[model samples]
Target: MSARHAASPGRRDEGRAQPAGGGDGEYTTYYGRPVVKAPPWEVDIPAYMFAGGLAAGSSLLAAGGDLTGRPALRRAGRLTAAGALGFSMVALIHDLGRPERFLNMLRTMKLTSPMSVGTWILSLYGGPAGLAAASEVARWAGLRRGPFRLLAALDRPAGVAAGLTAPPVAAYTAVLLADTATPSWHESYRELPFVFCGSAAAAAGGAAMILAPADQAGPARRLAVGGAVAEVAAEQRMERSMGLTAEPLHHGKAGKLMTAAKYLTAGGAALSLLAGRSRVAAVTAGAALLAGSACTRLGIFEAGIASAEDPKYTVVPQRERLRRGQPVRYEG
Candidate 1:
């Protein structure tokens, strides 16, 4: 068939269905083939994403606690942050299959590679977080003398350094995901960072609120509320901005998770505000926020996978780009 003829549309009476991708009346793939391979990532990947963000945000909370002289909050935040980082590392290495392969990522640093940058951020974040947590343990164990004294003295500074890196550490995963061939992730890059950041904050805050004494947990509660607000707002804006690309987030398995996240987070935030001096209410809110944060990460990860598996998302967008005279670089 001639190129023009192939590109031309046939009558609906002829049983030819219209392309749903909104392309310029052209088929871009081989019989609607997927343009990119869906990620072979397992549940561990989103678990890593969630744990890393929680660690980063908790590190920041630890720093805040140190600066504000909230010993209980600092102790809780530092331990929680360090523990989460350890889990994040394990999850990442688990996803990489071989532990040695995870080490290979440290061989070189590349500004363009989000994975490289994220690896470095995690490493830098780990040192300070570990030190702070260790210092707290030593102090609690009555070993705060000589070398331990120095560690105790430097804990605040180390926490501050971790805090400095925490925001990017929490947010870099979004960039890592966006720098992929997945249509949903790439399309939502603008909002993903904010979404991750807010989720991280909420997770960390929730942890702190649960572990810290109520008197010292005020900041944690506030942070949870603020983070929940940011998360909800960013998600709503992202869906609106994504237009048709947002379908996966609102349908199927991914949709169910997101819907649950919305309700859980909103309820948690509301409860945090209403639970004045009520321990039960505070704990409930914390649990809800933590669950909501996990749901958000899983939902987003699944949505990306769904988008990649669906050929319409890949072919239609590229076909439209071709019609617009834009360069189409296929992902290998």
Candidate 2:
């Protein structure tokens, strides 16, 4: 037998017979070879994630600003929240196969589908945030004196609404990814929420420092530090728990992106301590953290897609289960 033919199961010397097709024929399995295809959805999924993180973080920063009586930070936070929400809406709609049917997503609630839950959350949260942001702008334009008074009255209510939704906004994106067929994302579901929370916090903090006066940036800096620490801890725990499945974190482009994120997060947190005393340091560190968050988001999205593309991730575990006499359940 030729070297290629010798590698086939038909080449065994113990009463093995070649198939009728002969040596030149292509080998075929009972089922077709596995094919990996990207989801038909646009790349806007990651952008939506980024926007959601920004909105959540901005809301949290706004609350922090309110608690500390930092007007500048509060104003910046509110504006950021509005802008993020706007971008989120745009990205989500852009991702829809039938954009007009987007609203129908709210027709039912299925805990099994994170997208449904996220839709509801966004709907509820976006209303108040949008109102609050608009009111802030109106107030700035001195339109609070006329027919716009009702909108001004909505400011506090909107603020309250945003505050309540902030944490979930950060967390639900993780659930969104987890509910998908991606193994890397689903396996890291427990850690993904915390990672997003940190990214949001860092991004919001950076935006606040960039916009607000130095004194008003203090609370944002603290939030950034807290978020960075939480994110690092969560990532470490995820890596430890996933074992060989977590190989994506240490390989190729994903590894480089994650590495950059970690360094930026850590360095930014360290710099935040002295940011209050140095405006330049505060702006520089905040920018770094924001960039880091973007890298982390992109890396996570890529990793999840990679995991879904590899047939081994889907098959090996099932074979192992079969070897142990366990009934395999096909999820997809």
Candidate 3:
């Protein structure tokens, strides 16, 4: 037999393959082949994720502002949510290669499929968000007496509707990622939803703080602080709990981004306390929070890709699981 096809007596014992070739038992994959493929998503998918979460958070801010007599914040939140949702849809469609593919996904919903659930959540959140945003534009144009009257009248109700749907929109993407085989994302499933939701709230609050009059941004400041705390704490816990699967998140380009996100988020939250008294502080806090939220998405996305690129990350985890007698079934 040729060298590549040659078989050795030492290759097996008792009908079981021996340790891989000549390497240490630490490596599990044959010839460095990854056991699991990385997700095919591009930059567009992460952008879609970030935008969708921002939209959901903005909707919540809008609802809070409307009910509390903060007109500037209400307008800012409504406009931001609608704009972010639009960007999110565009990114998703671009990634899918056509708008029709998205429309087709709505034909039927599958409770067991994360994609199905996410599609419906986006659809349900889109309409009300759009109308609420249009109301801001109508008010800006002073069009209450025109055909825009209907949209204007429905503003508060539509804002409330969008708020109701916001939590699902912010969280479903994490579920979708976790349902995949990517080691980092899959391992961090328990904490990913909280991270995303908190990141969303922080982004939305930052945007409102930047646009709304500083004096009217008390709720935005509170949201920013609360969200930043939750996001940072969740990420810390996730990294600690994921063990081996989290190495990529702590020692690469992804690691730097995650570190920056933590500092910016925490710093922004602290600054927001003083935002109520200083416009400069409010703008700085808002910018920091938005950057932090974006970094979180990028960091997580990069970590999943990095983990998938290395066969050892995939193989080692499964081997350890098997060695420990843990259940190891992955759907895909």
Best by the TM-score measure: 3
Query: What are the per-residue Cα lDDT tens digits for candidate 2 across 204-250?
Result: 88778778888788888888888888888888898776554577776
Tell me the tens digit of each residue's lDDT in model 1 across 1-332. Answer: 11222121322212222343543453243344455777789999899999999988888888898899898988888899889989988998988988998778889999989989888888888888888888889888988778988998977788888888889888999999999989899888889999999999998888888888788888898989999999999988988877667889988999999999999999999988854488888889889999999999999999999887765566556657778999765673
The candidate, 1 or 3, that scores higher on TM-score is 3
Candidate 2 vs candidate 3: the TM-score winner is 3
lDDT of 3 at 130: 92
144 in model 3: Cα distance from truth in Å? Answer: 1.9
Query: Where in model 1 is the C-alpha error above 4 Å?
Result: 1-33, 323-325
Q: In lDDT terms, how accurate is model 3?
A: 0.87
List per-candidate RMSD values in Å. Answer: 4.4, 6.4, 4.0
User: Ten-residue segment with the worst summed lDDT in candidate 2?
Assistant: 1-10
**TM match of model 2 to true structure:** 0.85
